[model samples]
Target: MGLFEKLFPRRPPDADPRAYFKTLTAYQPVYTTYRGGLYEMALTRAAIAAFARHCSKLHLEIVGDFRPELAPVLGQQPNPWMDASKFIARLATIYQVQNNAFIVPVEDAAGRLVGYYPVLPQQTSIREYGGAPYLQYEFWGGQRAAVELSRAGLLTQHQYEDDFFGADNRPMLPTLQVMRTQDEGIVNGIKNATTIRFLARLAANLKQKDIDAERKRFAKDNLEGNNTGVMMFDSKYADVKQIESTALVVNPKQQELIRESVFEYFGTNEKILTNTYTEDEWNAYYEGSIEPFAIQLSLVLTAMTFTPAEIAQGAGIIATANRLQYASNNTKLNIVTQLFDRGFLTHNMGLEIFNMPPVEDGDKYYIRKEYAEVSKLNTETDPTGTTEPKEGDNGDHTGDP
Candidate 1:
């Protein structure tokens, strides 16, 4: 080797663990997502669950021969214990909640791929062992496991600063704070609405203990048990004034904006969560949210499952969602009526659009043959399959019979 090449030889990617997992100083918080569970917010949690459920409806399939076992395994159940939909939903939820997710393959005793599982580690650290990268998982139950990086598919969003992992939800803290404050204000308002409060002038010579006793006596007599809606005041007070308790009047517009900010962050809205989105809205959501997820997962799983050569040979995985499934009944009817006879879709497929069970012979494709090809309408070429124009007939036949 040349002297320069020998002296400055590049190290492999797994040479150092710190390269991917940055070491934080003592003042900085430890590795955690959303600053240690901001998703506990009801709105955020609901949005994540709804978004995940929507995405998990999509299908994941293996496209090539590199991993034939995955095709069947991904169809309905990825593992013996978990259904495919549940697996995908949990994966999506973890990825959203933590800003990162890891998918590791499960193998049988024979070393054959049996299933796939998404791991949620309370703490994740990268380690280098024998010149290879490994992910160390620390579970909340005090259980731990290690897996080679190559065997796991890592998916992350909002990724920046860190090399492999995604950034935390610190940027979203302000929005969540608004939501949190608004909720608390509403709760406080609801409580204050039903209670009657008053301020009254008391006798000047009354001691603190006497005043406390008087207040307790008033509460017990007027507010504790069921009684007529009336209060009798003694002459000890020079003035008595009832305080009007108004419910928390949060700015409706400000609250809407905050909700919109959260919805935008999570790629969802009230309509999306409630499943009232129109066809166009659903399509937009699918394109903006689900499609990118599908693409990333496809790539991540493809890489995790195949070698470079295998990928080059057209072996890969694909995840897809049927946005049309969310179309309105009228739109679905139109689609079925328009495309069914064109042979672009089969009878069973059209039925699927309506969520109906397939009938006998539904697999058959029926294409209309009543219409003939333009060239085959030629008067000069009856019973001949040739579509070529005649040499003299190339000129426009302007004669009008």
Candidate 2:
């Protein structure tokens, strides 16, 4: 061994727990009852659920000549524990909340791909060693595990940023604070409304004992929702007046604005929460929000699951959202008819549009007779536009001359 090597032995890169321990602090407030429970709030819950549902409905396909043999593992069932829909939904929720999702591939005894598992971003941390990233996973039971990025089998889908870790919704903290305050105000208003207050007028010289007796009688007779009459002494001069209760008034526009802020931050819209989006609006939402997610996921899956040689040979995965899901049957028919009439789409392409099998000779393109090219404008005329024929031409061009 060299003198330098003998003096200081080289060690494999190890994850530093302290590096990510601070991020856990940021998550602490999110687990609290008031703030963290925002997910359970109507607006927040609805937005997250809608976004997650949109993502869950996407269809993943292996689009290449040399398709990977792990289609079932990646598409149908990520593992025996969860199907594709459930897995995708969970990942979507994680993505909505944390702005990042991590998929760890499970391997069989022979190191062949078997299943997939999702790791919570809050429980995972990334650290760099020797200029390469390593992952440190802290399990629920306080178990800590480390894996190098090269062998981590982890695929990450996240909003693009320079951090490489991922972007989060921390930017929404101020808006969330306002939402929490509003919720607390509403709850407090409701609670205070239940308590009935009464203003009582008494004689100037009434005795303390008499005043106490009158107050007790008022409480007993004026029980909530009970209007029984109470008799009082004439000398007491007691008069009871019930305090008016006003219903809490929440501004509809302000509430909508707050909800919209939350939805917009998550790349969704208010229509998803209300389930009132038109077909076109739904398509726009998919394109704006879900399509980017699918693309990022496809790229991540290809990078993590396929070998460099396989990718070079055009073997990779693609995640595609079913656009037809948001389109009506009539709309699909109209679109297909228009495309077919314009000769912009082939028969097989039309079939693929509706997800049907292609037929023989379906690849041909056609144009209307009137729209066909006019070579000479008339079959009887030559290129010079002359109808006369030379010496060897008969009347029928049969060489009988």
Candidate 3:
């Protein structure tokens, strides 16, 4: 055997991660956001790749990470872009944002951040203002600034699915909905008790990182910001489902920076654009480019809440452990991809919404909402109108489209 096979004897020779990941027929797609400058699309791709590298090194497994060997066994992967697009297209058909620009999905490889095809203003008189720049320079600058808001960590990563299964149900098996049998003849009259228990353990093992400590650790190690942090948390009792919390740098100077960033985003005069451009002109120029960037910025802020030191200092952060559980390589890349798909996030206008929970016994408990809001984007508009083309799918578009 060759030296390559000595350490990892079972790894496939043609182990392209993308190919491998394509095998997960039932895998879900999680969306994440990226903004800032003109190269937001490229930056988002790079960040995701970097995250994947980190997870691979640490050996953590994100659901989207490709594994062809596992594909034949798992079934199929879900096409997220198509699903998101269908949703957005429906919304666009139902509701329009008046003059404001909106985006569906655009990939970096295509040289677009969101699928931004600018719509020009409706000009009534052709001769009076024939050559007026429908979108003034300031409008472009504002749109650019909106992308920058993503740098402020104002975007969110949301994981949703259009359907529960793949377009084709292969490897068919009967669906079994099971529950505990009340008053069965025998408590131990099971033929496969051990196997069922093992499966349950495997499920827990896959999602071990969802625990408060593990999620917080992942956030602190990967996310970066001067005064913000994120942590995973649940209430003290069973009544509370798990949620993420954040922290912020509440000092006056930091607050000022945030406000200025907001001003740049909403335009200096508190409108979508400055006075140099007329309403019709501004609307058309930006009708398709601004909304997604806005969405991305809001989500970034949500991720930036976790502190590196706080997460790294926890007991569960084992340096040498399962790569799937660690925040490196595959894990980071998966997060980056999901974040890119989720779209932009809104800035909370500098509200110190929540605080971080106290650490106990060398373990952090929760996330805070200091100077931030973790609300979803306004859904009154077409939620599905904002999707880009499917890059990795084998052409399986389901649902609305």
lDDT of 3: 0.26
Runs of candidate 2 with Cα error greater than 4 angstroms are: 1-38, 128-132, 151-162, 205-213, 222-235, 338-401
Cα error, residue 398 of model 3, in Å, equals 71
Write model 1 residue lDDT over 285-389, tens digit each, in one string: 888888888899889888877899999999988888777778889999999898988888998999888888999988988887666667555434435654455
Superposition-based RMSD of candidate 3 using all C-alpha atoms, in angstroms: 35.8
Lowest summed lDDT over 10 consecutive residues: which window, candidate 1?
A: 3-12
Worst 10 residues of 3 by lDDT: 170-179
Candidate 3 lands at a TM-score of: 0.13
- As for TM-score, the candidate ahead, 1 or 3, is 1
lDDT of 2 by residue, 120-206 (tens): 634665655566556655555555555555544433344344233555556677777878888888888877776656677876767
Better of 2 and 3 by TM-score: 2
Highest-scoring model, lDDT = 1
Colliding residue pairs in candidate 2 = none
Each model's lDDT comes to 0.76, 0.66, 0.26
- Model 3: residues >4 Å from true position, as ranges? 1-13, 17-256, 262-288, 291-401
Question: Compared with the true structure, what per-residue lDDT tens digits does model 3 show for residues 206-278?
Answer: 3445555654443454343324445333342233223222222235664455445433322232232233444
lDDT of 2: 0.66
Give the TM-score of each candidate: 0.81, 0.73, 0.13
Which run of 10 residues does model 2 get worst, by summed lDDT? 26-35
Deviation of model 1 at 192, angstroms: 4.8
Residue 94 Cα positional deviation in candidate 3, in Å, after optimal superposition: 23
